[model samples]
Target: MSTETVIPKVEKKHLENPTGGSKMEKVPGKPFMEIHDEINDEGQGNFPLILDDSVETQTQEDVKPKRMRKLTSGGQEMYEKEVEKYTAELIHYRKNLYILINSYYSGELETLEVRLMPDRINKELSKYQQISEKFIGFLKRYRTAESAREEATQKIIFKSIVSKAKTILNEIEIKLKQAQLAKSFATGRKFKPPSASSMLIKQRAKMDAAKTNLRFASKEAEPERLQFKLEEEELKTKAELLKKKVEAKLQMELLKSEKEVAIAETEFNAVREELEMEGSRSSGKSMASVVDPRQHIERYLQKQQEIMKSVYINPQQMQPPELNVHAAPFEPKSEDIRQTNYEINNVSVANELSKFLLKKESIDVSFYEI
Candidate 1:
């Protein structure tokens, strides 16, 4: 006991022993290490080392950020609600805009209305374009990470809406050119009434030759002043008849142009509504791709014509004189003609032409736009 001090061979962990006392046990699963040194005899020594198993390497999947997922049911419903709201209002505004435009084209609107029509049409088209852009943006935000099928569907809807909008503008251009062409044809064919002086040239010559007969008893005894008055009255009567004919002819052309424009408008609305309906189809099945809008429009129009043949006026079948222009609210009546004449007389032709040129330039610009 006085001189014995034993050294321990290894460090150890404590474990429960049988006699309720602690005992020393070597740690389990410890890595075995080996080292050899032959410094005098060996050329080199090698030792392999390893890190703890706790460190791990990550896979590619875990290293990058994830894409967004499809929207939830509630989010989809919300999207649908917003889209319908915008499209419905856009259609309503567009209809009103077309109505105003039709009025302007047919010369039924007041001078103020004519002046304001383009601004209002632009405002509505601007609104429509904005709504469509918003719809596209919203669709992208919610479905950016969508599967291929949904992505394709969204793209089709996007293209259809964009195409329909551009087509509407084109339709407007076509109608304007059509109306202008008709106006030119009418103007060229209109009758020119003779002036009072020109109408009385023969009478004046006869009167000069009959100076000798004035002294003799003759049927040519009417005075020069009364003869002049008679000729003037005859000329006035003929001029009124010619002017009335011109007015009626113009009214007829206006009617024809308006009918065609109304048909075009109907076609446009049909295409738009078809696109909207296709866009709103349920997601369970694959969405239908956009059909040809012209086909849809034609079928719709044809069906309407067949079903309501009595009320329907065939622009092709009827002559302009029989067009019943007064029945159409947008078409001009006599009062409307008078109003337009007043506007034209008061407003310079050059000013009106300049306005038209500005509008045409804008339309040309829009054609080049996406």
Candidate 2:
């Protein structure tokens, strides 16, 4: 048996086409969009890179959001310069578009200036697309960096350009509409259908007819109005006479009320005077009759002194009778003498007894038959 030689096996890869196809058969026409990548020094793309997808995602994550910034002097100057540069071409195309749309709505013939608006719009769009491509490339560089500040600045610039494009498009549409309206107004052509315009015209006619009828009606009523005015004047005269008579009667009533008020005032005064006189007379009589208590007491004391002088006699200086009071020591007798005739002068004996019994005192006695 002979030994077999070793063989190296090579694996083949079924590579797709350059345009993402299975084969190299070219498509019939240019595709709407194309993406190609050729190897570079850094293995980056040779064809236009698909930076948008990667940058957009990274930018959304890394970039700080834009805030409203106050424009600097330099920024303002730059903005003016940019405006001046772009405005000439834009304004030219805008004017042409305006005239075109205006005349179209006006039902007027199209001029050469107006006819060129579409081409101008397409050309501007192409130019904007080319600028956008460059702007997008700059944005990719900013997004790859880690600095949020620089990324935000780049984003602002990019957004400004895009916003400018949007504003231009919006302005174009607005101007077109304005031109259309202007043309319609100038030509007196109704923008709406005949039925709508006819309705408005009919409403205006109705208003005019109403106004005319009102005017004629007013004219026809003029004679009747004159008659009404004359009657009103006559009624006013009669009312004036009636008002005068009522005023005179009211004046007479007011005079009578005044007289009654005066009489009542006089009666009040007379009553007040009579009360004052009576009060004065009563006050005088009371003052004359009023006596002080001290004077009355003094007069009573003088009268008592006179009565005492009339009744009292001079005290007789009679010597006191010898009282044979035996002040011997008290003795208890064998038999108590029951003398019944006992006379007591309470004034003399009563004061002499210092230790008098504190009760109603009575004496009981009997005469013994001897």
Candidate 3:
């Protein structure tokens, strides 16, 4: 190695350079919007802002329609649809009522059915009234709608509704009167069933005494006590029939329950087999899910069913909620008309229709009493 090692000397240069040019130096500035606020000219109203023509056109193109202060449009169509619906419902009700009343007038209807007509008419009328009231309320709320055609149509429709309601009311009044008159004549015309001893003991005793007197006075071969003995035997037969009816109804209910159980078992078995085939066991994820509570519950029930299938269950702890349905017995159409809920004293019928009288019964004596 040489005594003097070749050492590279670093060169130093003094270089003066200006700061780098700014990136934004070449960018154009935004146009300034000048606002004039001169105080001297006070007589003239405040001048609107004068925007550039291009800027004004662009803003106008981008502008959206502003909301109206009131309902100027869009509600008329919906209102008309509601009116049509109301009209259709009212027409149907009127048609049904007309058919019933006319049938009664023509002697083509039963007295019992005629009695029911007024109630049916009144029910329909009440339903129509509710619809009308609802419509009136809706109309009241929308009276402020600024559409001229809408306002005119609403007035016309309202007048029509008022007229219709008045006509219907009158028609119902007439029919109700007809019903009341028919109902009045029907009083005491029904077949009076023998009263049970428990229901009316005093009435029953009075009736028995009256019947005994009639039987004695009339040409009956048997004695009064013998007639009562026969009646007791007839009552026993009626009781037996009633018991059989009760037993039959119970048997039917038992059959229904058994059928439901069989169906449930079949459905459960099918579901279990299907699940087994799919290898789709009810996982913990399927047992509970926040997204669908009903689906989770069904899965849980299915899991329980699977468990019941695999393991022996003594009895289910919970049962389905029972609905207590009380079916009303169909009473025979009795001519013995009961008083209705509403008063009918104010109601009146036509002179010709109101003259409904009880038929004159004729019983000529075949044998000479003298």
Whose TM-score is greatest here?
1
lDDT of 2: 0.44
Residue pairs clashing in model 3 are none
Rate residue 126 of model 2 by lDDT. Answer: 60
RMSD of each: 56.8, 29.8, 57.3
lDDT of 2 by residue, 254-366 (tens): 67666655655565445444434433443322222325423433554576588789887656955667866886777765333321111122222222221122111211111
- Per-candidate TM equals 0.24, 0.19, 0.24
Candidate 1 at 332: error in angstroms? 99
Task: Tell me the spans in candidate 2 whose CA falls farther than 4 Å from its real position.
Answer: 1-145, 148-215, 218-227, 230-240, 243-370
lDDT for position 64 in model 2 = 37
Clashing pairs in 2: none
What's each prediction's clash count? Answer: 0, 0, 0
Q: Tell me the tens digit of each residue's lDDT in model 1 across 74-153.
A: 97688667766755665555455445544544557654554455566667767766765665566556643332233333
Tell me the deviation in Å of residue 326 in model 1. Answer: 99
